[model samples]
Target: MAIVTMIRRDVLTLPAAELGPDNPLPPLRPLDEMHRIEDRDKEDLPGDMARQIGYAPLHSLLPVRVRDGYGRTRAPRDIDTLVIENDRLRATVLPGLGGRIASLYHKPTGRELLYRNPVFQPACFALNGAWYSGGIEWNIGATGHTTLSCSPLHAARVTAPDGGEMLRLWEWERLRDLPFQVDLWLPEGSDFLYVGVRVRNPHERPAPVYWWSNIAVPEECRVLAPAEEAYHFGYERRLRRVPVPSYDAVDRTYPLNSVHPADYFYEVPDGRRRWIAALDENGHGLVQTSTDVLRGRKLFVWGTGTGGRRWQEWLTEPGTGGYCEIQAGLARTQLEHVRLDAESEVSWLEAYGPLSARREGEWAAVVRGAEAGLDAVLPRAEVEAAYAAWRPCADTEPGETLAVGSGWGALEVLRTGDKLPGTPFEESTLGDAQTPWLQLLRSGSFPEPRRVTPSGETLVAPHWRDMLESAPAQPLTEYHLGVAQWHAGDRAQAVRSWERALQLSTSSWRLLRCLAVADREADHHERAADRYAEAFDDLCQERRDDGESWTAATAALGHEAIEALVATGRITDARAVWHRLHPATRRRGRFRLIEARLLLAEGKREAARAVFDAGFEVADLREGAESIGELWARITDEPLPAHYDFRMRPGHDDRPA
Candidate 1:
């Protein structure tokens, strides 16, 4: 056998609900608003590194749509998958779901190298929202998981460096407005899977770039990286440098030894190879190595604490085993974004496979053995040579189309008239989502929908905003123009635009919600609450079961309205709005929390406590959020339960109520 290399289409029967309609609200908050990690505890950092942490910050997620529409409800559904395989290894990639490598199997040992998530549970983990845990995830565009974590990406067949058929995944990262591609191939009879990744800047100005290859490995493995010191970022929102492997007298190399979820960013030296590994006691497990352009290496461990275990259960089925993430990135840490100059592209090749290290004296001894093992089998120079061979192939046109991504890429291409080599965002791929913007690009005016159903995607790019400004001053145009103005940091202009839209009969609930956010940001809480209440009412009245998309918008708006009302001491009105919510929406875990908040606001402490006793899970709880824990503390003085104890650090009392 000449080492079989082929790609095939397959189906996976999973209990996953479709990520329903994306939230219609333009993401008003900055991407890092909740993160608040800049210059955090910088006393322990090098001066240069501290400066990079705050550089090139993204103000908001304007052009990208939020994907909070998915719910906990799931049924047996067929999910499409593509398998790229050679004789020694087989990799399953979900092209429709962010081109996620769902599983990688080593054929000879009958072992799974990556954490193969047993269930498809959509949680609020990705940057835009919906995210599932498992396998090798290609994270590009910005920090956290890419907005494309649960979205589709274009996939096609291309010639590999070894003359084998490779699976290529490409997408337009809307937040950064960059085109990127990931090529997956297993060379003839090779144990390691090769990945070629490229991110290109087609614009005239410089742009910040962030890329991380997040690989999920089983917790049974010990994480190893080439560094003596590591920068630790805990959920407490603190960053400090600490010794590797033996931090706080607990060998941090073992994922389970710690008691909280945290990230250990290894400071790979200027001349060292970029690599990280998770290996078992027998020293046989997955190792990831990359070329120089990808500089960062990290180990994200959800440790042995109850909260970590609970998060593990929350991300998948309750009984599934826990896992850790070994990631490689372009900066020293995920919190930092490197600047990519105009018309420049960054490219690198990464290889992942099983390695055997036959030594076990200490952490250093184990890491040295692992490095020796890697060099003996697949040397660092070989990886560099492979990257050199793949450089020219990166520009080769895609051969056969396997899947299609969002039409936003094609719309961008239409507006900019830039041909992204290799990753073609063809005109034929345009769809309903791109209709209004496409019309604006061609006719020089945005077409207004007949019904004020709060439908259609919003575009906030400068080019689109300029076109909207030039278009007729219709309510729709003004509404979108306000969003663009807000994104451009012009709050006064944004307010004027929304007010102008409201002057017309075609004004909508979506416009009202945007104005409410502006008011809230401006510290006009009472006025903001009124706008939120009105927006929710209008949204509910107009939602004629219009579709799942409308329902998601309704739920989002209602949630915001209730929070505002409760915060402003409008308990009676909040209750009224809560009752007006659809029964199904009221049954959601997040809604249950809202109901508890309402109970507490109404002076029913015992009832609010009973809500926790009833045992509900907020499936979409954020990583660093203290909302649930804080609410529990407010309701009672008792110790938090194992299921609810997700605190990653101390000083809970210091947090504001």
Candidate 2:
């Protein structure tokens, strides 16, 4: 049977704000206040390995904008989805949402190979703030999650090497300024679905590259990789080498063997086919294998802990059971960023299918059977040959535009007519976000949108930075240039830029907020609070209710300003900022939490208790954040609800009586 592809409607609920417009402000929090959640830092040892781990740690996500505009409300809306199907398998892709393969269903077995998240609930997991769970997530860019986790990608039909139709998802990764594509197809009479990935650097500079195909699998399986030693990183923020399959006298290959969240990056040695499988007791589960260049394989288990279970529940709806990640990446560890030199590309072919049941009994036997099963389906030699076959196909132009992604790539290509053969970020794809940049590209000047509003974007790419630097000076220009400079780690120049921007427009709340962030990072809490208060007040002073897009900015500034005031023990000032918020904005879940914080700061335990009693949900509450539960316990004489208990540490959770 021939492969078929079509766009269908899926109810896109759970991402309440419709994965709303990105926060106009850059997403960098004060470094001092930012808890280092990722534990990819090297362990202290007397070796060059330790030195290598620190080689190019991403200090900041400067060029990329934060995606925090999505909220927790779950209103249903229609979203277009591209579905590709064959007689044997069916794959559903969300081009509007990071090109996530939302489902891979086996027709013969009637099983969902990947975790099919019933809802699109986004949490604060991506490098950008909003990230949802389940399916196959293609993570690229510097560590953590990709900024594209919730963003759309350019999707279209392309001719496969076998003359079949394939769905291609391409996007310009502005974080690294690289164009990449993922071509997915299922061959006729073949059980294994083929995925060809290519990332190209059109620029003349060495770019740090990271790619990980993270597949969410059910926890009711044993994850087997081609390594006996694994780098284990747990919630305590420590990386230690431990034995795979069995670590600390427990066989951790089973996802339930642990009690906390952890990453087991397998040490897939040289000459080994890079593959990992999550096989059930009967050795029937999903197997993912790729060619040599996509080298790393890993198993990320949230473990059997309550926090882990709670996180699983939070990402989807409660009672979705649990799932772990079996990932394939371009590096041994997610912390390590491989260098893709100037004008080069890296391409690989990956195959994913159900591992045939081996009828093995022991765990060791089941693992070996799993490996043998993969070899039977798609041998390493065949995978390498598939990579060779897909090389010329990588240059195949997209046939029909199935969906659209961001216009960042089109904006870049417009600036420097770089021709990427296969993935064309077309001129027509340029949207409102790219309009300002397009004017800058054509006129070498940025439009100023600084009256009672924040700049919609704060891109800090070297080219854009240089463009802004040479543009006619304005408050917006100076403010954006300062952001670029700050991201490039030039704090002094960044501060000067913001200060000058403020000089041009004294009441520009955006400039004040940027300066306030600089002060906060420098540990000047009082000064930061003062700046934040001024910024919030300035925003309020310039409101025109006739309908301007100031509500998001006002709420954001007001939230930050109140938090800063409360943190610095200025209770009255915090209350003033809170009340200054638009009534509609104040009624939102996050602001209610802020109101509680304000009451708690003023020694009003009863008032704080009332705030919780009033029942509010902080929609964008991050994973493992126990702040709400901690606050609840501190004020109210009641046990923390299961809803707010997001504690990931085993013993630190606020369990109810």
Q: Top TM-score: which candidate number?
A: 1
lDDT of 1: 0.85
Instruction: Give TM-scores for every candidate, taking all chains together and pairing residue i with residue i.
Output: 0.96, 0.93
**Candidate 2 lDDT:** 0.79
Local accuracy of candidate 1 as per-residue lDDT tens digits, 1-657: 756799999998887766777877788865643444745476567776666667776667777877776776678888899999889999999999999999899999998999998778888888878899999999887668888999889999999988889899999998888999999988899998999999999999998898999999998878888898998887777787899878667888788887778889998889987888888877788999999999999999887666677789878878778899999999888888888899899999999988877535676777787898899989999999999989888988999999999888898888788978889999899998898888888998878887656657778878888999999998888988989899888999999999999888444688789889998889898998999988888777777674667777878888888888887899998998899887877888788989898999889999999999998777677766668889998999998887887665644323211
Report per-prediction Cα RMSD to one decimal. Answer: 2.4, 3.1
Model 1 quality (TM-score) = 0.96
lDDT of residue 173 for candidate 1:
92
- Per-residue lDDT, model 1, residue 102, is 90
Candidate 2 lDDT, 1-657, residue by residue in tens: 444543344544443346765666676663221213333454443244454345565676666666656666777666667887777788888898899998888888998898877777788888767898888989988777788988889988888877778889999997788999999987776777889999998888888888999999988887887788888766665677888678667888888877788888898888987888887776678889998889888898887666687788878777767889999998777766787889999989999888865633565576566678788777888888877888899899998888889888988888899888998888998887788888888998998763545567778888888998999888878888999888888899999999988889755788889999999989999999999998888878876762435777777778788888888999999899877778877887778888887887888888888887778867777655678878887787676776666677656643320
Error of 2 at 398 (Å): 1.1
Give the runs in model 2 whose Cα sits over 4 Å from its true position.
1-17, 30-52, 359-364, 450-452, 546-548, 636-639, 653-657
TM-score of 2: 0.93
